[model samples]
Target chain A: MKAFKESILCAGHGGQGIVSMGKLLAYAGMQAGYQVTFFPSYGAEVRGGTAHSMVRIQYPEAIANPVITHPTVAIIMNKPSLDKFLGRIAPGGVLLYDAAAAEKIPEKTGVTIKKIPCTAIALKLKDKRVANMAALGSLSKIKGLFSLQELIQCLPFIFSGKQDLIEKNTEALRQGFNEV
Target chain B: MTPAKKILITGNEACGEGAVTAGCGFYAGYPITPQNELTAYMSKRMDECGRVFIQSESELAAINMVLGASLTGERAMTTSSSPGISLMQEGISYLAGCQLPAVIVNVMRGGPGLGNIAASQADYFQATKGGGHGDYNMVILAPAGVQEMFECTYEAFDIAERYRNPVMILSDGIIGQMMEPIEVRYPQKSVDPDKSPWALRGCKGRESRSIRSLFLKEGALEEWNRDLQRKFRTMEAKEVRYETYKTGGARLIFVAYGTSARICRAVVDKLRQEGVKAGLFRPVSLWPFPYKKLKGLDKGTTVFFDVEMSAGQMLYDVRLAVADDSRVLFHGRMGGGVPEEADIINIAKKAVKRK
Candidate 1:
């Protein structure tokens, strides 16, 4: 059996919900019986310049490195995120990004880039706030780490009390997954 | 035992759940960055549990409230950040002088002055060397991640109750603000205020006990000091907790606690893959210092690197543990800066070359 270990990064400004993306990944990883770790950049202004969250998931063996200075997957929600993190992705790694938030996609080798208009899809779903859900959906197809169904199953855990966001967020996730 | 559920939460929120599970009956705390979530969680939960939760006007008031609650033999606690904790040192000294059992949490941030709201472990001296003006040592549990934040908060109350002294759950902004999965395994064990013989509970049917720190009578204060010293020695022998990784046959060892330890673990694993033997010694109980296990590093070991987020605070303890036989090297960053793994890896590689 192969050991499962992959580090993912979600980067954007404060309001972009990159931290939520990191958390959703962790919740989904836990449900899949994988050990997980999540950390956000401290001391950064709550709504200030580029903010990022690092998450790592591994099987049984606890996430060894509590902090991921280098990630296997990079999810860029905005241009500032790309500028700061575009160089850190592992070789042959995966990049799931939002074309709506950033358009000047830098050309890089060895890695695969999937550009999904996450914000545009969320706005079309009538809730721009669910852009993070859309981004998570697109990340599902990048490496097929978690089944889209499993990712969908973790939604109720994330937006538990909201009740109302369950429907649109799922729709947004589906749209993002299919677009990739 | 496998936990029934896993919930993603920051260390601060996990500490809140831990305190609630530990039967924290009275919580009086002022809000501070990186630790505000703990106060907020207690504020809502304590009311539902029919306990007293006061958002005191200042940390000074909050700590004194904890002192009051503990005098009645109730399990009480207060959480604060670095600066806020500094303000509560005097009250903490009083708790020690009175021999009151209380729980104090310092979700430490950058220090010295009103430093930036980032992570640092510079307060090790203040925490272990008696932050207040007195000869006292609080049982300090340094949690590396969110899960320990929850479990140790519960255990901290138990230790304080057992030792009849203050227990501190020390964490940094990184640990406090970071989100991770945790399971709250223990439920709160409520303590009745009327149980302790030293408790001031209406003074009915028995001799009245006065909870006072001032002993002006001759030899009275000296006796209390001796008693405290013996208690401290007893705790040191019984309560040193630490974790070791790949230490059985290693060429290098890393002495770190909390977040820095986690980073060092990564570097150790990486170096091991490249055939350089490395290990990590993490002290969970910062007060007892875990010098015994650390002193066992055999002659096979080449060097020890003391890493921290502060300018050589815990490094001093690391040196004392190893006692200067091996070269105890130090590398750290401070004032809200985190120690990157690259710098640590570089430091270790340099030591390997010199060796």
Candidate 2:
């Protein structure tokens, strides 16, 4: 396999598990024997506030900078995040967003935009909060950076002792991956 | 020897773990933004190790608690952000004057006066220049990544005890909150307070010993000051730690520390890839700064570019080291603004062109 390097940004409302998704991605990257850094930014409010995280994964070479200005991939879950971060994506980058929030995504020349009804999919799985996980699953399919199984293995670690939540999230991941 | 295990952790928590692994017997800290996680981590981990952890009522209480603990020769520590650290300056001075072995972790944020809860290097002067009233110096270590946060804090205790003086781990909010993988290693032996001969355990078997900074007799205070100055000189001579990247034949060098240095490292790689011979000089120990090492890297033809998150607080030291104001250039962002790689690259390219 060629050396891998990727900078991913996950952004949405505070209650949407945006930070959790970023952590899961970073943990999976570490498990795959890659160097990873995860940086989170949010307001004082624990819910309903804007939140985002930057995750960088690199192999063989050390990652020098933790803050990602122009992400290669972006997972946007709400309208505010989509509007704020869509134009910041690198040229030829991939953007995975929630269809519910991105009604008028402008066309970009080299970027690929995939709109998945992440919240709707999570509702089908009986927990709309896993919308972030669904979006992460779509990212996995688009980039093929890590297998769905790899992400599932990280569930127990992140949500330890919460078996029901883990099962529901695993299902949500599978659904999103299949949809993509 | 036991092998180190890889784990993902934030810089704040890593420093806490470093303290615990180094046999920190007591911890006292008040909650503050960008550094509250460290206090929380200690509340749990310190208890697990059968050590003492206190959520002090205020920053004043915390530092005094640490001082009390250190007087008994216990490995003691306290952590805080910019405003909180400012509140602890008086106690830090006393720690230095009394010649106590203690560690202080400053997870710095935007400063001057309750600036903001964002990453910053504004405390550079306060940390290295003896922020308190009297004359004293603290060994300051700047760690740029999560791994270094752990390693630096782990070694800080030993460095403090070696000189019987206080040591400070100067970090920023960015490093404090960012999570990365690090190898966690435990020390072979924990610190034992009983081994310290000067500890005021009691006057059971021998005459009592006293520790104080109040030397008010005729010329008595002068003798104490001389002793402190000698210790500072010895530290400057023996404890200068730094790292240089691709400076062998570079025409331009970026001098930075902490988060700014991390960004400069990437800029160096990008500049080199574009056929520009750029290098980086990062001072890991900020107090006993690697001044000689930095000055030696100056070839008469090279341009030294200084980058920081403050309004050139460290620039003064850089100029002093190079000994030439005209040979150095500065690029900085203040009030929680961080220096970006692209802007640094642009500035460095222009400098190279002019050179």
RMSD of each: 2.0, 1.8
State which candidate has the highest lDDT: 2
Q: List the residue pairs that clash in candidate 2.
A: none
Against the true structure, candidate 2 reaches a TM-score of 0.98
Error of 1 at B191 (Å): 1.5
Whole-model lDDT values for every prediction:
0.86, 0.91
* CAPRI accuracy category, model 2: medium
* Residue B246 lDDT (model 1): 88
Residue pairs clashing, model 1 = B21-B188
What would the C-alpha RMSD of candidate 2 be, to one decimal place? Answer: 1.8
Candidate 1's C-alpha runs over 4 A off are A42-45, B1-4
Off by over 4 Å in 2: B1-4
Error of 2 at A108 (Å): 1.0
Which candidate wins on TM-score? 2
Q: Taking the candidates in order, what DockQ does each have?
A: 0.56, 0.58
Q: Report the Cα lDDT for residue B154, model 2.
A: 93
